[model samples]
Target: MTWDLLLSGGDADIAISGGRIAAIGPGLPRDAREIADVSGCLVTPGLIDLHTHVGPGYWGIDPDPIAWCSGVTTWVDAGSAGAYTVAGLRRVAETAAVRVHALLNISAVGLAGRTGESRDLANCDVALAIDAVQANRDLFHGIKVRIDAETVGANGVEPLRRGLEAAQACGVPVMVHIGTAPPSLDEVLDLLRPGDLMTHCASGIAAPLGPSVRAAAERGVLLDLGHGSGGFAFDVLERQLDAGLLPTTVSTDLHARSLHGPVFDLPTTMAKLLAVGVPLDGVVEAVTTHPARALGLSCGLAVGAPADIAVFDVRKEPFTVVDAHRQTRVSPIRLVNRATYVAGRLLPPRLPAPPAPWIPLTGAQRSALDHRTRAIRDLLTTPLVGVDGLAEQFPRRSK
Candidate 1:
């Protein structure tokens, strides 16, 4: 049978038809309707951002399709929605061009802080989370708990314990946000089962899992690099990586604040990992198969699965990748998104636009927020060029 699309490179030829891969081999059918000659590109399963806050940023009505544009065919909204807000997320998920899923926040208010964070320990209502999970069983894959010291406050492990309880009851995995206080990383890891996910695996200044993190990985608990600017630490990551404690999945803990710098999208994250010695296949697995497995979604590019593909330029170019903590590495090799296809439909290229309302600071304003208001004045002066000059945009202060 003729395929709808064929992407060949690296001894892999993925033939797609009816939204699933019909064949993966060297020879191609000559009568295919469309052909993408991705010879110079790295042909891999469409990327998946297993964690993100793309929803609630654009209007709480639609998920930002940046992932789709960046060769991410599917994404799992990490914990942008809790019981109170999941309904809206469901709406957004439906409208998204990419296949979207969720690890519903255990907090009833969901990600309510910037939009809002449900600080009330009372808001960690397991019943509500379970109810939401059941209601959106197709979209809501599991549960999410932000076990940060600031987010959890004095509630300690009580919220985490409840989140685990809900996850257990639902027979689904839990994706926990680590790097917080109250319950140490060990305590949080101890609470997780084999299939559960740990976002921000290398986060804050100090993260959980080094030797212990390796043990957890060996035991089947998945570590994810949900690098959200401040959520990643190079030294800590290096220690973990050197200890053979690598992440099973790679994700951008992307959101309004961390989208521009430090987190340039999934491809940049993959490039940074490659620069750090992660093999291309390993990196691809982390972003593709491993993430899909974590999210319990199909990504095999096999027959019946979605016909999603991400082509990247694995070229040797002078590239500087940064993490949340201003750690920069200048490397000559980088991976860049060439194109993305969803169900055999190709996505177009997009140029970066002015900072959206959700992100009030331009790249320069972020660097100058602590200095003078000169950057803001510059933005006013140059409305045409806009604030893209601020390569280090910071979070806007609370009004």
Candidate 2:
């Protein structure tokens, strides 16, 4: 458990009931159904993954298993759904017990069919985006626009302009994914006001440690390293840091494509940052308080804060840290989750609850949202992108 009082020092006890943090202190009445002692563990608020893609119309990975297994309580599905597609995707994401929220995609089609959502420009319908955000104001937290060569094609700055237009209307932050630019890094930074975000800041764009980034920071433009399948670099981040740039929040841009290699999970991302010279406290704050504030999610160990806590065992051993581009570094200490508690229900469950919306390792939601599975079945009945076609992704070199 990463307690705020941890730094102050002392053994404190916590009590939970009625899906809330009932109390916290050094001692309390021992009158409870069960009691567990945590003599040696680092306790903190439940980790919030501020960026993820975990629903259909994309290569969806059911979020609960990975999320809970990683000690994540709140998972934000970043731009995986949009105006036209959010309704069904929202259902799939919410069906899991993991608290799920989303940054509504600016494009109407979302990430369906490996399609470049904003490529058509017509997909950036501000009215439709506004409607979606308004309709799902409960779960929709912000707007997302991936302004890159693949997503936006040569449509320079227009998609972001439209996204900003809709975000301004909806009164939520606009998270801009910066990659192979149609709108130059400078152009994107220029358009972003304070509170707006630019993710993948270390993706080795022309985002040099220079005046533009400095100006953005000065104006309170929040930066995040959304370390995705291809969104981080060692030298790039180092240069930015040397030039006084820093991430306000850190998140795993977790998706099916990134689940295996390069970006494994949040702790792995945290370890990589630790290897890069960011202080331990900063690393902790990045995932905990930083994202909580950025996304306006209730987080902490206080009585009113969501009863979400993570117990970590700090390991003082050597570990391999991998960056988004497969770069490696060695870190001194590894933060390992000893246990996690969300709303007082212990994770790695002490006693399994009845058919809850929690971890469903084999749960296949057979609703209409299961259309992606049905489509996969249809493809299997016909043919896949064949072994050879698939093998192209992992080409073998001649012996």
Candidate 3:
């Protein structure tokens, strides 16, 4: 499937050796020592997350353990540090358990806090950014700029301009985060080239799905679904998808705070897109093939492409999913990952964590929580007898 042609579906098996896919067919000799049965699960290339802050930032998290648990082989930390601080970021990435890459922040301080990185235009040193990219070309693949209300309060599109300058100077791509606009989405789209990426596409929308987005998309300006804390609004995504415009790649703009709410994990984000009416195949491709292409990484199920693979169970169940705007939707399918292999090395998925403890609650809050818990416990003790019991415990929303 990596090549221009499609794969023929039949009973098939894949073999790996020396950290590369060796053969794929039936009746292949057991070249390796181990074999396991993986029936009734969909397999694809290892997922490449294009946007994250898993480095040493305020919202950063250690990526490798999470990556292994989530079937993510390649994790891109988006703009956690800037030109002056990227050396430290590189040092951290070098010791990571997964394949780690980063985008050089246009601002010199780079997302140290929520505000003031681009408030002063002097903070964006194009020369220093280019120098950093050149110095760490192996680790830094692109440039990152946040064009939101906080990052660019009065500076307008100057931060983006410097980001573009740095990208052009270093001959790499630019990943722009869209937030509240003073320069406007139209102006931002005008500057981006074909290979450049516009993240947070499902964020706040000021207008309908009109010609501006279409024009940029036609010019090959890729859109990215970076579902951060409040970056993805269901209405915005539905409106855009209704216009037949979908993101080229999907990413979980995962940080520390967002992990607890609206954006739980990458699998939840993928399930959200599937519930929003995107095809399941397209959803998997967005995380695998599309992101690999966007980030210039090699990934596939073919021989010698890479031995990385991910296996998941496509569960069919009724679940209530929520978006960043707190709107709930029903998903008929959930993608639960089971395992990931990095360069022919196997990594198994772990069990999901238990529910959060009520330790951080106030005295009144704890009392209320205990009361609710006991009420639910009482209902459970007498449940499943009849419609009356079910209705009393799980009442439908009042129409």
Candidate 4:
């Protein structure tokens, strides 16, 4: 059977048919209906962000605009919706071009507001959470609970206990967000199961570097670098690296607040790992195979796998990148996405919407946004070509 699309002349020739990779080799047939020449680009599996917020809520942001340019195909909404608001998130997942899965919030209220979701213990209903996960098995991969002073308040680890109960009942893992004390970082880490994830493992505020943290790592609690606006810090990551602890997954907690600065996209977040001395291959694995394995999702660029691919122009130039704390470091290489595909269909370019009113932006950031808007407007308004560049479809009577 003929192939549907051919991605030729990249790192390797890939033939896609029936929404899966038909073949991969140095040379392939050029008879596909659509052919994209991707010479001088790095071809790899589409990235999977393990933590993000894309549902319709306070922190939600459209993932398509970022996905097309950043090569992220699967966006795991980390508790933007819970039992009460999951239907709305379902509608979003169904309509979006990119794949959107979620971790059901322990709090029934969800992130309708910034924080304090688990302040009221009634919101953390284990039965309701178990029901939600069991009912929507396709959409929810696990449960998410924010354990910190701001989110849990006086409840501390009680919400986490209820979340764990629900996760155990549903036979799914839990991804716990780590932040400032009250419950204390050790209290949260001790409760996580072997397969459970500790997001923001290298937070400046939490600084999960004590004996309990090491013990948790030894016992098999996976560490995830959920680099949100305040979750990541270069010093903290470096310290962890010195201790020989590498992040199991790298993700951008891309929401309204973090999108503009610290966590621009997955590529940028990956670069942060690079700056901290992680090898390129390691960083790629963290974003692709590792995260996919964590959530039991399909990923990779092998024959018979779903054709979710990304082509990037790999530049071996120095690039200055910053973490959530505004500390900067230079990366040896930069990965700029040139094209992204999902299920053998190329994603179309999409412009980002204006930042939300409540999202604070610096003067320089505002100016940059304005400049980008004008540039896009100018480009779309301009003519495709001059008169000479056009040809008439209908000839005159002589023709």
Question: lDDT at 47 for candidate 1?
Answer: 84
Clash statistics: count for each candidate: 11, 8, 0, 0
Give the TM-score of each candidate.
0.85, 0.83, 0.83, 0.98
Screening candidate 3 with a backbone cut-off below 3 angstroms (N, C-alpha, C), the clashing residue pairs are none
The deviation in Å at residue 207 for candidate 1 is 2.8
- Write one digit per residue (lDDT tens) for candidate 2, span 233-331: 878888888887888888888876666556768887888888889998898899889888887888888776667877777788988887766678888
RMSD of 2: 13.6
- On lDDT, the candidate that comes out on top is 4
TM-score for candidate 3, please give it.
0.83
Clashing pairs in 4: none
When 2 and 3 are scored with lDDT, the better candidate is 3
Q: Please identify which of the two predictions, 1 or 2, would achieve the higher lDDT against the true structure.
A: 2
Residue-level lDDT of model 3, residues 128-221, one tens digit each, is 8998999888888999998877778888889999999999998888999887767688888889998899899888643325588789889998
lDDT of 4: 0.93
What is the clash tally of candidate 4?
A: 0
What is candidate 4's CA lDDT for residue 192? 89
Model 1: CA > 4 A from native = 1-3, 8-12, 57-65, 115-118, 209-211, 349-399
